[model samples]
Target: MTGGTPGPPWSWVWGAPGPPRATRRRGGGRGERPAGHSRPTPPASGPAHPPPLYQAAGRWGTPRAAVRVGLLCRFAPPQLPAWPTAMATVVAQRLSHLLPSWRQAHQEPQPSGQPEPVFTVDRTQVPPLFWKPYVYAGYRPLHQTWRFYFRTLFQQHNEAVNVWTHLLAALALLLRLAIFVRSVDFWGDPHALPLFLIVLASFTYLSLSALAHLLQAKSEFWHYNFFFLDYVGVAVYQFGSALAHFYYAIEPAWHAQVQTVFLPLAAFLAWLSCTGSCYNKYIQKPGLLGRTCQEVPSALAYALDISPVVHRILVSPDPTTDDPALLYHKCQVVFFLLAAAFFSAFVPERWFPGSCHIFGQGHQVFHVFLVLCTLAQLEAVALDFEARRPIYEPLHTRWPHNFSGLFLLTVGSSVLTAFLLSQLVRRKLDQKTQ
Candidate 1:
C-alpha cells in the first residue's frame, strides 16, 4: 500500500515469506488466492532474515519499482544475481570516465573566467574535416593551441616527428654556425657576408618549418600565417643560396655588370614563389598551374645557383682536383627532388592511409630530405670558400652594403608583400564564412 500493488505470493521462494496457512487453506487453491497478499514470515518470527533483492519487491513496492530503485541506487542485495550487478557497475564506470572528456570537448565556456587550456580531441569531436586526410584517429590532436606545444611535445601525434626533426636540424645548424664563426673571420672578413647569409638561411629554413608544424593545429588563422611564413622561408633560403654562389663563383667585374639585373630578378622570383604558395594554398586548385607556381621559382633558383658549380666540375679535367662538394651537390639535388616528390604525392601514406600516422609519413620524410639538402649545401659552400681563399678579395670593403644589403632588401620586400596579399585573401575567406 505504501508504494504500489503487492508482488506475487510465491515471490518468497528466494527466502522471503509466503501466504498464511489459514489464508491458503480458506482459499483452497492457488487460483483462488487474492491480490495484495502480505509476504510470508518465518514460522516462529524470532527474526526473519532479510529477503533476497528480487523477493523484497513486495515489501517496498511492486516488483518493477523495486528493480528500478535497485538499479538506480546500485544497492542490489547480496542475493541478487552476480553477473547483472557486475555489468551495471562496468557500465556506470565507463560513463563516468567518458563524460568529463565529452564535456571538455563540447561545452561552451564560462564568460566570467580565464580561458581553459585547449585539450586535444578526436576526429569526431573536432570541427568537421578541418585537417588533412590520412592523419587517422590518434594522429589528430585537435584544439591544441600554441600554449600547449610543450605538452604536445610528449604527445603521440602525427606532426610530432615532423616538428622535432626540423627543430633538431635547426639546433645542429646553430652548432655548425658556432664552429663556422670560430673557423673563419665571420665579422671581420668582408667575404663572410655570404657565409653569414647561408647560416641565416639554414636557420630560417629549419626554424620556420618547425614553427609551422608546431602551430598548424592551433587554429585556421594561425595555420595559414605560419604556413605562409614557412613558404617564405623556403624562398629566402633559395635566394640566399643564389647569393652565396654569385659572391664566390662570379667575378667582381661580371657581378658589377649584372647586379642591376640579377638583384631585381632574384627579388621578383622570391616574391613570385611566396605569393604563388599563398595563392596555391588558399585560392587555386591543386592542379598543374598551382603546382608549377609553387615549385618553379625555388627550383629555378636552385638550378641557377648550382649551375656555376656544375660548370666548374665539368671544366676541370683533373680527377684529383674534383670537389667533394660537387658529389654532395649532386646528392643534394637528388634529395631535394625526392622531398618534392614525397610532398606532392604524399607517398607511402597515400598507399596506406592511417597506418603511418605516428611515424614514417610523407611530411616527416620531406623534413628529413630538407635537412640533408641543407647539410649538403653547407658542405659545398664551405668547400667553395676554402677553394677561393687564396684569391678571396674583401669585396665588402669596396662597398659598405652591397650584396648583403641587396639580399636582405630583396627578401624583406618579397616576404612583406606576400604576407599582405595573404592577409587580404584570408580576410575575404573569413568574411564569406561570416
Candidate 2:
C-alpha cells in the first residue's frame, strides 16, 4: 500500500511473499483457464531461476551432488534457436537431393568375383597355345586376365610349382648376393666386374623365369612375349657364367688356349641359345622335337660355358686336395647334368603323365636342380675370386674393359634376338587370325 510495490496481505502470517495472481489477457481468447483451476503465473522477465535441487549453493546439496548420487531428474536440454533449425531443415532438404549421387561417388564398388574359380584344365581341355608335351593336367585356362593369372601364383595350378621354384630361388640368390657383396669389393675391383655381371644375370634369369611362369596364362601374345624375354634371361645368364668361369676359374695355360676366341664365341652362342629358345617357342613344336629345339642350343652353351670350370677341376694339382672351390665346381657340374636330364627327359611326368600334374613334374625338378647348379656355381666362383685375387689384381685393370664390353655385347644381342623373335610370333599370330 506504499509508494513502492506493497507486500501481499498474508506475508506477515506466512513469513514470505505468496505466489503472484494470474492475470487475464486483454482479449477474452484462449488464454483463459477452466472454471475451478487457476494456472501459476510466470515471472515478468529476467533470467529464469534454476530447478529446486540447483537452487542451493552449498556443495553437498548441489545439482552436481544430486547427479553423482543418482537422485537428480534429467537436465533441461539446451534450446536451439528457430533460425538455425529452419536453416538446418533447408540444408537437409538440399542435401537429400544429392544423397544418391554422393553415395555412388563415395561408396566402394563391391567386387563381382568373376574369376574366382581358378580350376585347372586337362590336356584335352587346354588350348593349343598353352600346351606342353607330357603335361596332361593342371594347365591353367588360357586368355585369363593378368590379375587372374597372377592370382594363380598362390593357387595350385601346373605352373604354380614352376612359378614358386624360380621365385624362391630368386629371393635366395638375392640374399646370397647381399652376403657375397660384403666379402668382395664389387665396385672398386675391376676384376669383380665378371662376378657382378654373373650375379646380375642370375637375378635377371630367376626373376624372368618366375614372371614367365606366373603370367604366361594371360594370352597367346603375353605367353610368347614373356617366354621370349625368359630366353633372353637364359642367354644373359649363360654369358655371365662364361665370363665368371673364364675370368676366375681358368688355368693359365687354358686361358692362353681359349683367350682370343672364347669371349666372342660365348657371346655368339648366347645369342644363338636365345634364338633357339624363341624359335622353339614360336614354332609351337610339340613332344620331344619341341623340347630338343629348345634344349640343344642351351646344352651347347652350358658345355662351352662350363669348360673352364671342368678343366680347372680336372687339372687341380691334387685330386684329393680338399679344395672347397673345386668340390663346389664338381657339385655344380653334377647338378647341371641332373638338371639337363630332368629338363630334356621329362622323367616321372613322361612315365606317369597326369599323375604328376601339380607336383612331380620334370620342369619343376629341372627348375630346382638348375637353381642348385647356379648356387653351387656361385659359391665356387666366389671362392675362386678370393683365391685368385692376387694373381688377377694386376691383370684386372685391363680385364674390366674386355669383360664389361663383352657383357654389354652379349646383353644387347640377346635382347635384339628376343625382340626379333617376339615380332615373328606376333606376325604368326596375326597371320593365323587373318
- Candidates' RMSD to native: 12.7, 11.7
For 301-373, candidate 1 gives per-residue lDDT tens digits of 6666665555555665663555565676667778888998888788788888868768878878888998898
Q: What is candidate 1's TM-score against the reference?
A: 0.66
Q: How close is candidate 2 to the true structure, as a TM-score?
A: 0.71
TM-scores of all predicted structures: 0.66, 0.71
Position 119, candidate 2: lDDT? 59
Query: What local distance difference test score does each model get?
Result: 0.68, 0.75
Pairs clashing within candidate 2: none
The sequence of per-residue lDDT tens digits that candidate 2 reaches over residues 167-283 is 998999889888977887888866777888889999999999999989888778888999998999999999999989988888777776887788888888898899888988888
